[model samples]
Structure formats: structure tokens, C-alpha cells
Target: MNRKTLALSAVIGLLAPVLAGCGGSDGGSGGEAIVVGTTDQYIATDEAIAPLDPAAAYDTGSWNVLRQTIQTLMHVPRGGGKPIPDAASKCAFTDRANESYRCTLREGLKFAGGDPITADDVKYSFERVLKINDPSGVAGLLTNIDTMESDGAREIVFHLKTPDATFPYKLSTPPAGIVSKKDYEPTKLRKGFDVSGSGPYTFKAEVKGDTVTKATFTKNADYTGELNVQNNKVELQPFTDADEMGKALDSGDIDVMTRAMTPEQVESMVEKPKEGIQLTEMPGLEIRYLGFDTDAPTVKEKAVRQAMAYTIDRGDLVTKVYGSVAEPLYSLIPSSIATHTNSFFNKYGDRNLTKAADLLQTAGIATPVKLSLNYTTDHYGEATAKEFETLKDQLNSSKLFEVSIKGTEWKSFRPNQIKGDYSVYGMGWFPDFPDPDSYIAPFLDKDNFLNTPYNNAKLRGELIPQSRREADRSAATNTFSQIQDIVADDVPVLPLWQGKQYVASRDDIAGVEWAVNSSAELLLWELRRGPGAS
Candidate 1:
């Protein structure tokens, strides 16, 4: 069995914890409010705008909060599947080509603040995303939308610029979250931590300076949606690091832990089970990757990038650094997604010193290619620094590269990445939705999310658009394979490892597995106290 399978198989016997620990505190009318601790900080700065506003929020950190507070027309179901109705009563593509889609608002839906939700609000919410077009926002995802029209208060229709089969999946994301037209302005972002939506929860955050220290979610009495809210309230606390978050869980300061926990912490929990803690493992779509600034001086040459790809050993990094918590990824499209290809492995196989030397020698580049690798310090996890050090050792051992490592916090690192300041940098990706297009389009397209100067004409201009034309996604496998093959040849980005999602929580808390979705958004309503608590 593979590492992921073993992790899941071992979980069956190890999850038996019987302890009457301190249950959640009473949440007035909503009953006991379950508290969840997370290391995923809600970041907003002059450099990168946090997803406090649905129009400006794009990253997973912001989406986690938005998914709970803001109601989208549709949402992905729990335990992994396609999206179903949430706010909308029914929705379907009006045209056979997938160019036109329509949704009918569910009856009697209203925002948390007592404003009625309507089709006009949905239209305004999407239009603002296109109008503001924040550099850090998810505006790129809405480019296909040519025009949207709302007929009265109950119905809305979308006309797409192209036949995009992935449009529904995009609707299931945080960017598509329906906002109150009354509360949010048309041209600018709606600032502050207060959220007004028609989802299952009404959110209020405690902000110290710019960071959100704590947030509370009260069950929305006005909510009319598919989710069956089990609890009256839920509290969220954001920690700066995983260790601090784990400590909070252990001390009963928090009831559940999600988003991230270091490999060492997970291994320790498995080897010696803690008294009241239960670890639940789920399939993760998050992938760590290295992106290069092709215009930069050091790694501008394609051969230099190719040589580095051949030298680094993903197995060694997973074994030594991650310790069976992660699996080696050879494709930009992870194994969890459909039509994934192992083009990188097929071309380069495992690490080969001879291949690295020949690529450099043929290009007339001298030995020991000097490189400075950049990474974000606080964003990914605690294991990142160690992961880079292991990479440095692997490249140096090949005798064809000399490397130096630098770490910057996410706020500073993001702007520098946008400006192409670093020759090579590391970043992690969590899919906006569960689709192969989400993996390919954001990196390979002309207007890429990375803002790096590595857009390939064939992949961007031809393959991507062709694949989108197919209404049945499985029919686009050949096009996806070709795209992956070209990506392997170009060597612009290198896939490192794919992570396995884990949620460690107190045994008293139920629905740990269902708390987080396949897209990595935390569903606060899924969490509830187990039977016989308090």
C-alpha cells in the first residue's frame, strides 16, 4: 500500500477515544458553540488584498471564511462530489454549447442582517468582481462571462464568451459568493470583518490591528439553503504557527484543529496516541511547486531549468522531510483530479546525475550553476525551510549547481513574486474548484495567477480553449495530456509533492472528516458536538 492508503488504513483502529472532555460553551439560542483552531491567517495588506470581500478574496485562507458566511448560487456537496443547489432552487445550462446558463433563486432567502437576497444581488456581486479587477482577486476566473442579466428578483442568466464546461465548478467557489447589493458598493471593496450573506452562518471577527485574532459564527436564522445547520454557533481562532495551534487544541482552549499540522506533529500523534485527540485523514489536492521567473538572469535558460528538474529527488524529500505525510507529485495536475498525466516522470524519470550534466554541457554552461531560491516563511508551514534545505543538498550533490536559500513572509514575498524579483521561488496551490482546468489555466494561461513571464502560446492560445469547448470533460483527456507534455518540455514550473489533508480534533467533536471539503474550504456548519456531550 502507498503512504496515503496506509495512513487511512491505520486510522481505523487508532481513532477510538472515549473521554468526557470539556464540551463546547453554550451559545445562547444556538446551543453550544464549537470552537475550531486554525493556522490559516486571513491576510490583507497593501500588497495582497485578503478575501474579506467576495470580490477581492481569492486565496484559500479568505475562502474558508467566505464559504461559511457568503452564500453562492451553488456549492460542492460534503464527502466529495459535484456541486448541488445551495441558494438557488435549480440551475442549468440553457444552451447545449454551455455558453448560456441560468439559476432560479430559492424562495424566502435573506441575508444575515435581514435584507432579502435576490437575483439582482447575484448579478451585482459578479459584476463587481469584473469592475474592481483587484490584482490579487479572482477576477480572471470571470473573464469568460460576457454579460449577465437578472429577470425580476427570482431569476438570473449568464452569457459566456466561450463554451466553458468548467463554468459550474467556478460557480461553486468563493469568488462566486452572492453578496448583498445593499451592503456592498458597486466599484470598490466592502471593507471590515463584518459579513452579510444568506449562508448558514453570520460571522463577526475580532480584529487586533490588521490581523483577525478570533471570529464567531452564529447560525443564520434567515438562511434558506441545502446545509442542515447542526449547531447554534461556531468560533474560529487563527494562530501564527501550527505548533501554537496544536498547543491550543491539547489544552482544551479549542475543540478542533484544521487547515495544517506539521508532519512531526502528525507522526507523533500516530506513534503515541494522545488521550482525547483524534486524527482524521482525508484526500488532499494541495500541491507544492517551484515557479521560475524566465526573464530573470540566473535561470532564464530552458536547459538550466531542465537540469535542475533532473537533479532534485522528490522521494528523498518525502521520506526524510515529510515522513509519509505526503506523496511525490510528478504532474502539475494532481492525482486527485481527472485526466492527470505523469509527463514529468515519463520524460525525466527519477533523479539522474548524467542527464543533468549533459543538459548543462550541451548548453555550454559551466559547472556549479549558482542559484538563489526564495520561499515564503509563514504561509506554507514549518516544514518548508527544511524542504528547501533538502532540495539544496540534492542539487549540490549533483555537482552541477551551487544554491543559496532565502525566506520571506507572504506579504513581502507576494509583491516580489509579482514583480519577477526572484529568479526561482516556491509556492503552494489549493484549487479554486475540483477540475483539471483549475490546475492548468491558472499557470499556463496568458493572464496567469503567478504573474510570471512564462506564458506558452500553444498551451494558452490553442489547447486550453479547445479543451473548454468540450461539454463532457472526459473527452478533453487528449488535450490535457498534450498540455502536460508541453509543460514538461518547457520546464517553467516543477511539481514537488502532494499533501494529505488531516484534521486533528478532540474526540467530543463530531464530523471532523466532513468539516473540510475537497476544495479545502472549511464548512463550519458540518461541525457539531458528539452525542452525550454537556
Candidate 2:
């Protein structure tokens, strides 16, 4: 990374208080140890990882855990860099056009059942995904793929219909995970007990929502370090709440805890050291925002939307609700990354309730330009209600508008936001892929999941596709910066803050440190029960 990139990392370091000196206890108390806790329950989201076939995969919280068990064709590291091979042994570009590509497979690789890994499996993964055409289908990744054929028993070549420079990086995403061709048949799907894959770890059992899911890794005796990180074994247990996760970690019931602990939780843990708890920090790609549904009649008026944007006190929200663990965001792109520009903050800084009222008055907003605010009840935390409550107070007290807040579970909150259900809502995005494109395309792209029936001719016509179509991404930086400014002026989806990825692990569990991308997916190989642990 250049100085600019390094400086960005430093800024993130200054902003990350979520996991700074975080820990509640040490590991190992002898009673069925190695439990893990999360904020959400596992819902059927991934077809490969979901309980049944015929379902599609989307980047949901529930699917995150499952994707870890299944290996993707490639994975992007935390810091800014190229994609690394995860499933395939070696992938290369065949045509100079950056369209056609071929990937060589690793020899002697076996699934949990010892099925030989082949190039056909790689071909089937994406083709089958397009065949199902799941509503949230990741077909966008394969836009240039005309056909995928095996060059040899161990090699696969993807012939593209157009020049697609991003194909290599796109293949690295989880949606592009290699599936077993034998397991996946034309007439049926593989979603049930046939959950098998060739990874460093094997899924022994998955006890749905309870405290039991064991993935045993016997060092892959046949493996010669295709997977850089390898562990003796892995044990996973899921807990639903932060309090439960924290208590479990505190009492040495589990090896690690996450998302469950709030900013205050870290502070408390840091202040009073517990037995086996030790906290460390890593960078992450998580971004949280307060989305404004422009489809709402009231918000369609730029003045009202601008006022709503201006009225929000992002700093106070960060300090009060997030316990200073989050940093204020000005655009959809996060500050830690290069594509980010503080356009929103530059335009709308320091919640100015007085100016917000003036803007509403100048726009001649009539009595009760009422707005329906929505949020996910269980996803963020107990304080989520209070955050929106604060939003309601600021806007209502500004006399610009009246706000009514409602809460729903995440499962509902996701689909509704894509459908533009409420006037405004609070939702966060953990990048499906690490690229800046991940953030911009998902929300602003007209064809994306957040359908956003938006007609931003400028963004759609120029900024996005232009960048993706070109071979050199840096050439499009100016266009993206322009997009940021346009997005700031439009105020359709207002980004509130970006939170650092955090983990509250036992002090004994060594090597459980943070990643730059702050990838929450715990690599068993990177984690070992330390001398302090057992």
C-alpha cells in the first residue's frame, strides 16, 4: 500500500475502539469448551450451505457462517490487494482482453467423502446458480461468462462474451464457491445431509440454532499446504445474545464472542480484567448507514431529505449509541478504503436542527410531512431502538417533520429495504465482496438487490459501468469521486457511520486477533488454544 493507503489504515486505527484492549476472560475450564456467539440466528439463505436445495444464496448474516464452511474459488484479503485463490490451485487470464480466463486445479484434492476435485465442479457452480436464477442470484458476477468448459481433467477455461476485467476478482467472492458436480444434478439440488466439500475442515455436525456444530480438521494429512492456515480441529457453538455470549466468555463457557458485545461491553471488559479474556484489534470492511427511502413522497422532495440528513447528529449517535466504536460516514464508501470521500460530511456536518427547520420552511413543507422510520430489532443491538428514537427526536424537534418509528427482525428488514417499504430505515452492509464496487453497486445500481428504481442517469450512464468496463480501476477514480458528490447532493441514502469489526475472545485463545478487512470468518488454522488457554 502507498502512503495514502497506509494513512487510511492509521485513521481507522484511531477510530477503532470497539476491540481495543478487549477481553473478558481466558480460555479452558474443562467443561465442553470452544463455544462461539453471534448477533443473528442461522436462517436458510445459502443453497449450498442452506438446509435444502432449490434455494438461492445471498450475503445475509445467517449465510456468513455457512459460507465459511464451504470454500470459494477465491478470497480477498483484508487490506487492499488482489484476490487470493481459495478453491482453485492457480487461476490466470488467457486472453489479453481480460475476458477469457483459465484456472488450474489442485491434484488429489478430495471432498469430505473423498470425491476427486475436478474442473467440472468449478464450471457447475456458476452455471447452476444462473440456472436457478435465485431472486437474489449472484449472476452479476458471471456476466461475461459465455461458457465454462474443462480444458483438461484438472483445468477449467471460462470463455467470456465480452471483455470483463473484474472477472478474476469477481470469482474470488463466496457466491462463486465451487460445488460438487456429482452432488448437484440437473433434476435435483444438494441442500441436505449431503453437505460435503473439500476444505481444510470437515463439517461433522451442525445443530441448527443450538450450542453444537463441530468441524473436525485432522491436518488434511494428504494436503501439502494449499490452505495457508491449518489447525488441528475446530469446534463451533452459537449463542443468540451479547449478554449470553459475554457471560459464556467470562465464565469460560466458550473460546470466543462477537457482535454480541457492545462498545460499552468492551470498555467494561477492558476495565475489569477477567480470567482468560484478551482483546485485540483488526481492520474490517463493515459499513453501517441510515437509509432514506427516496420513494417515500416526503423524501422525494430534496429539501425534506436534505433536512433529514442535516438533522442527524452523527457524532453524538456514534458516541452515545455505538459507544465511540463507530466513525461518522459521509458516503456509502467507507473512510478506511481509498474510494471513500467525505462528501456527505463536507455537505452535512454537525446536526444543525435550526438550519434543518429553515430548509423545511423554505421548501414550504406543509404541516406534518410525516415519515415512517423502520429498523431491525435484533440485528444491531438493544440500543438500536434508542438510535432511531434519537433520530425521531432530532427531526421532530427541528419542526421539519414528524417521525414514527417501527422495528422488525432482520429477515423482514432486508427484503423490505430492497423493496423501499419505509420512508427511512437503519441498515448496515457487510460487503458481499471487499471492493468499493460492492457498496456502490448493491445500493445505487438500478439492477441490484436494492432495486432502487432510481433513475440517476449520471451514475448509471457514466460512473458505475464506465469504471467496471475499464481495465484500469484507477482511471475511474475521478468518476467515482463525482458519484460521491452527486450522491451527497441527492441525499437518497444517507450513510450514518461505519463500525469496526470486533471480537471478544478469551485471553487464553491465542492468535484470535483482528484482520485488516476485519473478516469475521474465523480461520481455525489461525486460532489455537495457547499455553495460557489450556
Candidate 3:
């Protein structure tokens, strides 16, 4: 679930407008309330449950709310360090094989409403995710767990079907956020936006129909966790348009704006910001690409898919669609990850019209091969329309492919794509964690997120498992490199551009750099009003 479930760095832009002095209505010190604006929205209906529910939500917006409202056994440290304890007093692997793990909770932990948090709550939280198995949920991240057993009220042990060194990192994510067994149903998603957990904050949302318009968070006095709460209160306001969000930040309606902004907006702010405004830029791991259902009739031919890859011009996309805000990605794994390689570049080099024609000609396929490309109209951003149009233009220029593009809203787009309704669809991946396994396993494994008919025996059955067994993750670089090579050969998915992260806030806002982790979960507790803030 990145905004796909998303990741996080900093360049600062100081704007020139004369703001109403530091002593305004909001207050004059660090205790003032904070309002954070975002373009990310949370949608729930009878068809889709409230994303704030830990068992059902998988996207970034939902995860952000869950992060502040619930606590996990472990959490990734700021600036990309190893996961440290959060709910638990301590956690460790008990077996040399890395198959058995255990945790001991802190004494006298309580939820926001004074409910005691026991080992059973932790067990219930995880088992419900597996039991509900929501189509759009993060259940895929917990597939490695085989069983769990509780030792008294504080200790919980987990047994895995196979070795998984990345399990600790997975636990730090949203899916493992401990929920109260008394409040959350075992098999059904909770009906509304109210959340009760032992996190640093207690949450309440104002909903209009199926949409959450305003989300409020107050420091949870009854909670126990590793995070040091900074602000006494935080409010989240969601907007459908980036420009509108930018305007809110400009008018001082919101204190901090993050999660997403159009590249053009970022470039404009970087060049000439309004007075009293500051913008920060950081390295992001969000990758957008084209996914092909290998069994779909239109894109079933391997040569056709390869020719489409050769026909795409990533540079053109960077220039026309994203400007200078994004980098052209050659591999599925972004450069921020360790084992990244330019396998696609090494093989295809550049967009070659001749090689594209040759590939199709050699396969005895007819020229102007007709294909339909599908993209989501709302999910990614406004640039997505232009991005896909650029893709269609590139493929049409090669004359080896005829492409018709269609756009759908995310509500129908995700489920339809999973059902294999589209031949080739545009999608994005935000890593579940900071490791290479988050990038590779979700796409290439037998039960991949794309729902494509792809299962490379060598890569999936051997290399992936072998890499997970290594306690030292850096030692598995070669294995990940091999996996990238295999993916480039298969061409089931075509790599597009990877984006950068941007957060715009008032100069008086503090902790913008530490508000988000490498894995992209928003840590609201890190935010506060700086000295001289209004």
C-alpha cells in the first residue's frame, strides 16, 4: 500500500511573502496545534471498508492514520536504521535458522481508552489480517508466518514456514499494528473511522458519506511506546487537487503539506517560493511502471512486450511529464535500494526503434501490432494522463505497435487489474520496507501483487528464498542482481520513472525531515511548532 503503500530526504526553499508576524491566532510557541495538508484521500464504502482499519488498509494514506493511532511490536528508526522496539520491551530471533521469533511486551500497556493490551491483542491483530484477507490489503506481507503462541500476558512467539530475515522489518509496517481484540471484529472490517489503540496518539475522524474530510489526533496519555510525542494535537486535511493543497499551505490554512505534490508545483516552489514558506526535497523509493498480464491475449507474446519496452523513452517522460523532479528508472528496484542495477539499460541500452522493429520482425509478428494500454486516472497524480499519452506517442512512433489508452478511477482500476481485465496496465509500487526484498518479492513471487501469470522457477523458487535466509542482507546483493536480470528478460513489467519526495511547510514548522521514515510511514509524533511559530 504506498499512496502504492510509499518511502522518504533535503533541499530547502525559502519563500518571500511578508507573513502576519510570528504572533498570530494559532499561538506563539511549540505547544500550538498543527494542521497537515495532503492530496492523499481515504475512501470506504460497503464495497471497501475504512482504510484506517489495520486489517483492511494497504495504501499510504490509510497507513499514515494507522501509524499514529496504533502501535507495532517494532518500528524502523529515523534516517534508515535497523528496527527498534515500540510496543514490546524487546524482540529477538530464538533460533539459528531465523524461523522462530519472540517478543516480550512492556508491563502495564494500555490502549487509548484504558483497555489493557495483552499478548492476545497482538495475536488477534495479526491473525485477523490473515483471516479477513482483503483483496486490497497488506496480507501478502505476512504470508511467511505459519503460527503464533502466547506465553502468559506479555510474551508472544511466532513460527515461520520458511526462513525470513526480513520479518522484523515487516512487523514494523502497518499490517502488524496491534489492535484491541475487544473492539475489532475477527473477520469483518470495522465500520467507521474511530480508532482506539496504544499508540502515541488517539484519533477521531469527521466523515462525510464515504470520505474522511478531517482527521484529528490528540496525544494519547494512556499509551506506551518508543516514540516521543512532540505536538499536543495534529489535524489532517485531505484535498483532491495538489494546486488546492498548495494554496492551503500558502494561505497558512495548513502548517505542513506532504505525501504528494505535482512535479511542476515542486519545481515552481523550488525556483520562487512565496514569503514564509519552505519546501524540502528527499530521495523517494516510489516507482511507476507498466504491468502486463502474461496470459492476456493482446500482450501475451513475449516479443511484443520486449518491443514495447524498447520503444519507450524514459528520458522523454522525465522531460515532458515530470520535468527535473524524477529520475528515469531502468530496473524495478530504485537507486535508493542496495542491489540496484541498470539491467534494462545494460540489455536495451537506449530506446532503439530499429531493435524494436527487428524484435517484432524476427518473431514473424505483423507490423503495427495492435495493443490497448490502461492507466488509472486518479490514483497516481495529474501527470499520469500525460505520462501514458507520452507512452502511447512513443510506441506509435516506432510503427511496430498500435496502442489505444484508457483511464479508470482507482476504485475500479485496482480490482479490475487484479481480475486480469486489462491487457497491460499502468501501476506504481511503494516498497513495503527499505530492503530489496520489498521491491523484488512483491512482483516476481508466485503470488505477486500484479496478479500476472509469471513464476520464474529459478528466481522465485531458489534465489528469493536463498536471499531471505541470509541474516546479513548485504550479502544477498548478487541474488537480487540476478533477479533483476531475469525480470528484464521476461519483460512482464516495464520500468518507468522513479519519483522524489517533497514536503512543503511553513518555515516555523519543525521536524519535516524526521516526520517520515525510509519506508514512507508518516510519524506524526515527530511534528511540532518551532520557536516563534504562530
**Candidates' TM-scores?**
0.92, 0.85, 0.93
TM-score of 1: 0.92
- Sort by TM-score, best first: 3, 1, 2
lDDT of model 3 at position 75:
81
Clashing pairs in 3: 1-4, 1-5, 1-58, 2-5, 2-6, 15-275, 16-274, 16-275, 17-275
Off by over 4 Å in 2: 1-33, 44-55, 77-80, 144-146, 159-165, 185-194, 204-225, 353-355, 358-364, 469-473, 514-517, 532-534
Which ranges of candidate 3 are over 4 A from the true structure? 1-32, 532-534
lDDT digits (tens) for residues 242-337 of candidate 2: 777777766777776766467777677667655556555556566777677676786778888788778888887777777656787888888776
How many pairs of residues collide in each model? Answer: 2, 14, 9
Lowest lDDT 10-mer window, candidate 3?
A: 2-11
lDDT of 1 by residue, 1-534 (tens): 011211112222222322323334322112377889888777556665444887776667778888888898888676545568889999999988989999999999888867888888899899988898876637878878999999999999999998887787788877788887677888878776667788899889988877788999899898999999888899988999999988888887788888778998888887777766778776777899999999888889999999988998999999988987898999898876667889899988879889989999999999899999999988888899999999999988888999989999887887888788899999999888777788888887855778768878888788999998876677788999999999888889999998887788877777776787555678888778876432
User: Model 1, stretches more than 4 Å misplaced?
Assistant: 1-31, 49-51, 532-534
